[model samples]
Target: MDKITYDGIRNFIIENELTDSVAISLHPDSFDELVMDYLDINNNQIERPFEILGIEILQDSTGSVQKNKVNILNVV
Candidate 1:
């Protein structure tokens, strides 16, 4: 992600007081292992549903940052 997007997300998390619930994983299998690992590592036993926004940013031929895929995962 670019600096602007990163900063915006960071600010949103901080302002909403969701620092403990959000995690960023850059690996290919981020959704499969990283999310689970984060939950286990943090011992987060959240009873309610939480959302994970998976953003895939890529550069087009013109070298502009483009958002390719956005997947919203609701984990209960």
Candidate 2:
């Protein structure tokens, strides 16, 4: 998985014309995952346009989860 730099994320948001309401809804960690996945699909090394299919939260019912798992779906 590639790492999404702060600048890369900023550029993506700007290009997409994402409003504050939409941007604020995204989890901070999910942003990186979303960016990297988008890059892979487009075969690009930098930020570009993409659409979010959905955002999912995968949690452990065992009550031992140290961190939450978030899946950012970009395609069906």
Candidate 3:
């Protein structure tokens, strides 16, 4: 799996024009865990965003499930 760092993730969202795309991870996987882990490792802390949008992650097939591969749908 690719190492998605804080800057990498922030850049990815910016590049994708997803200022509102982040907030929460839809899936209960290591991606979110990794983010938290990274933050913990880096000793970084962040407050919740104005709108911490929730998501519904659609898991993929192949019997090889991953959190980062989740297809996120905004929570209405």
Q: For this target, which candidate reaches the highest lDDT against the unseen true structure?
A: 3
Give one digit per residue, the lDDT tens place, for model 1 in 36-75. Answer: 5546745865222333333322222332322422222222
Q: Candidate 2: count the clashes.
A: 0
Q: Judge candidate 2 against the unseen true structure and give its global Cα lDDT, from 0 to 1.
A: 0.41
The candidate 2 region of ten consecutive residues with least summed lDDT is: 51-60
lDDT, candidate 2, 1-76, per-residue tens: 1444334455555665654334222344545564666677668664223333222222234433222232222422
lDDT of candidates 1 onward, in order: 0.35, 0.41, 0.43
Clash pairs, candidate 3, are: none
Ranking of models by TM-score: 3, 2, 1
Clashes (N, CA, C under 3 Å) per candidate: 0, 0, 0
User: For this target, which candidate reaches the highest TM-score against the unseen true structure?
Assistant: 3
Q: Candidate 1, after superposition: displacement of residue 11 in Å?
A: 0.1
User: What are the runs in model 2 whose C-alpha is more than 4 Å off?
Assistant: 24-76
How many pairs in model 1 have backbone atoms within 3 A of each other, for residues 3 or more apart or on separate chains, i.e. clashes?
A: 0
